[model samples]
Target: MKRLMKTTIAFILMLMLTVLPACTMSDSAKDLNSSAKNEVGKSGESITLRLTLWGAPNEISVYKKVIANFEAKNPNVKVELQSIPTDYDTKLTTMVAGNDEPDVAMMESGSIALPLAEEGKFLNLQTFLEKDPDLSLDSLVPNITYSSEVGNIIGIAPGPESYALFYNEDAFKDAGLTAPPSKVSEAWTWEEFVEVAKQLTLDNKGRNAADPEFDPKNIKQYGVNIGTFWGAYSNFIYSNGGDFISADGKTFALNQPEAVEALQKLADLVNVHHVAPSPVQAKNIPATNVALQTRKVAMVVDGQWNSSSLADTNTNFNVGVLPVMKEPVSTVVCGMFSIFKSTEHPEESWELVKALIDPEGSIDMLTYGTWMPSLKTWYTEDELVSKWTDNLKSRPSGYKDAVIDVMLNNSHQTPTGYVKNFNKIMDVVTPALDKVWLGQQTAQEAMDAIADKAQAQVKGRRDLE
Candidate 1:
């Protein structure tokens, strides 16, 4: 009887041990969930922060590294990256309207930044910058910084970018030209540039620009490839003393005499001079492919990002960089990061921002040859300038000087203002401008119509404000 009683007690204890563990586990799980809910204010601590940006494959890889580094440093913060193929503005607009905006977004330097800032969606960074002494706003390039600042700095410039002319050296040599212009100050004037372009242009018969039988229709090569995008057009307009919009952002100035003259000059390249491809012809050929691979055009104005793309191509031709117009005027576009007011951990977010844009990190971007550092000090530093020369050995004689001149003296912002619908205005203007390029309407006729429509849209935006 004693043995049986002992066996029964042993069995009961074993059963209790097994059951007790499960009960304890259930309670522990409940406690964990409760703690997480409390910490995250009913949402949960595993909040997924989203960031939206657009870049090439390599840029995506670098961004992923940055995010991974940020995540490893921040164990509690989980970030989700979102990439848009194209039409970033549309994606951003849709997400913002749905109240499903990413925690951070990358935007361009033109009217996009200004309009978004006016919408009050972006958090003002001025307060944060003033409070944080470690983040030296002075370190940034003045022109780029100025462009990124919307009203009172809703964004911080992280990358500085400028446009330069890319020319095919072999093409110039074949045309028997001495050398391409090197300095922005010495950059070929419109008339002089046209002359060089004419000489470089070729037809199937090997007849040069001097040959009367040089076939415009059967031409095998174009003199220049002017990017037809709005940003590209802005350079021509600005150089010709035209403004896209008035200072108030309420009136459209694109239809002014200067603006019309600029558009006419671009049109003349195709219709009158017959040295460039028609709008229809240009549309058929991809801009990058035309400039880099086919070498169909002798010169093209593109940004630093093109270097990476061209380097990956099979083309053996060396590219020479040129400044904007002869007057040495160009626009600088930049990308920036902003911290939102709704962030649960402002301090941590700011730390991430600083890590991503610090001098060392900025130099990493510049080393890739895809971007220019926003920090002004990097321009002259032996380490930074060396990279430019090392990678672009065959750069045109005056290319470096022109880049320095633009960086130091002549860069300008695209005019951000209180009008919230500035991009919408661009949407309308680009298509109308395309009509002029297509020869459907004259430059003045197209600009006049577009100005009337844009002015009404701008007025509506003003009324909303």
Candidate 2:
């Protein structure tokens, strides 16, 4: 049931996450950029670059501003913005089959971009990126950069967003517990987190899960809601020193002992400890902010984009580092900005890609809080971090240590970013994991049953392997 709810929410949030915020820095564009405009025609005919992206109307509206800015700087170029809000992947396929692919596209990493890049559909921007005076592949965060071949850059994530532990401060006070650790080194251990949960989880008769007379069936407020989705759960698998796929990308590894142990601990929270709500019970819970505000659950594991949603709630909520099993780990997930091989104006399209991804170009996006900067300097340099986080209501005080520090020092991009045929592999793996969430099978039993089928789809890791 958690999977079912998350599937629906993921579709909407994933779409929300994929929308790229356009640059509004018109006055300083020339001062900030050193690259010469690659004019389309020597004869002065206007070159129109077709740009395709998926987003809601609100997101699309901001993107149009970005396009307008690009056009302002390069007066000879015209950009036709094609916003596909629904059936994006299917429509992109239709465009490909019809030989009408857009000049540039914002691609969902695993589902659309990597598979197409392997088939030679997207342009290799390696040479362009290397020669660019303003930015290089090294300018971005290492985890968000990708290449199908060594030194052959294919696509780069336009922004970065990762998973973190969000909790209600008021709930913590009620339980007489301190807030979760803000720094990675101070993160709680698995046992410590469970013990805290037991104290917070309450029954109808005002008994905690730790109470001898506590009744699981009468649970009124759960201590936590652990996401069963891969994006949320995979952090734990990696923290336990395991992975869904091997680093070489040729093996299915979720059946390994380390992975099994991490997953079992999460299951134990639901079935054994009863500190977490069961799938059926969770169906009634609202969104993350509402749940925390209503005190339906004390803590939730979710993406950083929830920061904006959390700001609207009256609850005194804050974020903290996820507990460690062995390593302090979090998963970063984002779509890549890629130029299609079909583009007649690769130079101009590359310019558009660079403009959209530059953090300075999209500062409004960062301030509004659905996105994080894609560049490493944004995390490592205090000046850059302050540019986005300073006095920003959505960014709580602990954000620097809990979100920024962890992303820089202890983050891994989701397997979807690098693993081949990731969507296909998940199709075989998710159903088996569903049984684990349902309490119908142990993590080991469920994974063992499907490992063979999942392994058949393992081709090789595509990104920087």
Candidate 3:
């Protein structure tokens, strides 16, 4: 009789524990729904939203100003900013695992956000995006969309950064060479670019790379210092009419002739041509602005965001389109802002997300050259383009053709946007690339050795979903 009573009591206690919180959650949800329908801040009921971001102190300061602007407009909404400067993905994942995710968060699309979206952890923002008069997928730059599933957008890049050639104007003048092309139509072919690079490369004795007296062992200044990693070289591969994976995404394609050739040229710039530094040599190289200001490198192939620092450091630099192997192409990429599905106040959270992505709300980022506008109208409309670039210290002359036009017409979204398990595939592929960059192996040899392993991890593109 006592055992039966204890069992009944234990079962009843278990039910109470489970059912009570659920009932409380339901009541809270109802309150949130009522608050949302009544137009959130209109009801005079204050709400706090948690937002996560990963950036340095300067970036955080900029974000705080933006957040303050958002708060000024909506007195009832208060935001708690959580800035994680390092190990962001690991910490964000831990928060999600503990069911303590922030209402809205910034994440690298291909690395963290898209993978989580695949597990239904993020809210499907399709309806919100479609209904919002101010935002639309159609209005965004082509190929920058982030969706693992068709017709569903879980997150989006607020702004994009694209690759361009940043050259020291004085260096060009000193070398007695014309500036690199600013227009896409006039972009240099790979061969033409290399010939120019050879002229610009100089040893301590003042002999250029093209001269017989030039000493690779005592290079005083490099002609170019193009990043040899996936972020930079992938654009070259695409320009060569090849890609890291096949169109169907089933096969690894880096071993193809065109892709191999592009990578080989990059390697030869160090090993044979001696116009650029090897990875070891680059370790001592400073940031783009510092490197150029000190004449450490005559030209740098880097992201547009470098314009901010170039301006800040007062470097006399000019922008140009990247040299093409076959086709003119630049890589456009940025992180994403997303809302977690676990939030009890999704509507309020969405309000914060909207403000975060709104161009006007973050105008400082655009004007200061840390980011480019993601909206098509910003690039197409002269008035809007002037708002960000005209009279700005960061945007030099030719920015319209070199950056805005190229971004609008000649950009390709980074492969991370559509390639599933891309990070994993790269794990198998990057070491092999390192060998090519270090001159330990030929591009063909390195890629061939990793072909089977990389393909095994491909799984396919996310669009297949």
lDDT, model 2, position 224: 94
lDDT of 1 by residue, 1-465 (tens): 447645755565556557677656456556554654465543334445677778777667777778788777666677788988698878777877787766777776444555566566666666667788776666667655432234366666666666666667677777888555656556667777777778877788877565788887777787777767765666777777876676565678778888788888887777767677777788655656356467677777666556556655655444333433435566666677665545655666676666666556545455555776666666667776665545553332444565555765666554332234557777778888877777778889988887777877664323121
Cα displacement (Å) at residue 197, model 2 = 1.4
* Overall lDDT per candidate, in order of appearance: 0.65, 0.84, 0.86
Where model 1 places Cα greater than 4 Å from the true spot, the runs are 1-50, 71-80, 84-98, 108-116, 145-151, 248-250, 314-326, 362-365, 387-389, 392-399, 415-420, 459-465
Deviation (Å) of 407 in candidate 1: 3.0
User: Model 2 compared with the native: what TM-score?
Assistant: 0.89
- Better-scoring candidate (lDDT), 1 or 2: 2
Better of 1 and 3 by TM-score: 3
- Consecutive 10-residue window with the lowest summed lDDT within model 1: 456-465
Instruction: Select the stronger candidate by TM-score from 1 and 2.
Output: 2
Q: Model 1 scores what on Cα lDDT? A: 0.65
| Models sorted by lDDT, best on top | 3, 2, 1
Candidates in order, TM-scores: namely 0.78, 0.89, 0.90
Candidate 1 deviates by what RMSD?
Answer: 10.9
Highest TM-score, which number?
3
Model 2 CA RMSD to the hidden true structure, in angstroms: 13.4
* lDDT of candidate 2 over 1-465, digit per residue (tens): 446644755464444445523434442344223221222134344789998898756567677888889998888799999988888989998998799999999888777777777778988888887899988878877578666666666787777888898999988998899999989989999999999999989999989999999999988888999867889889999999998788777799889999999988998999999999777788888889899989989999898988878877677988999999999999998877888988988988999998888888777778767789998889888898899899977788778889988988899978886677788989998888878877999999999999999999888776543
Candidate 3 structure, TM-score to reference: 0.90
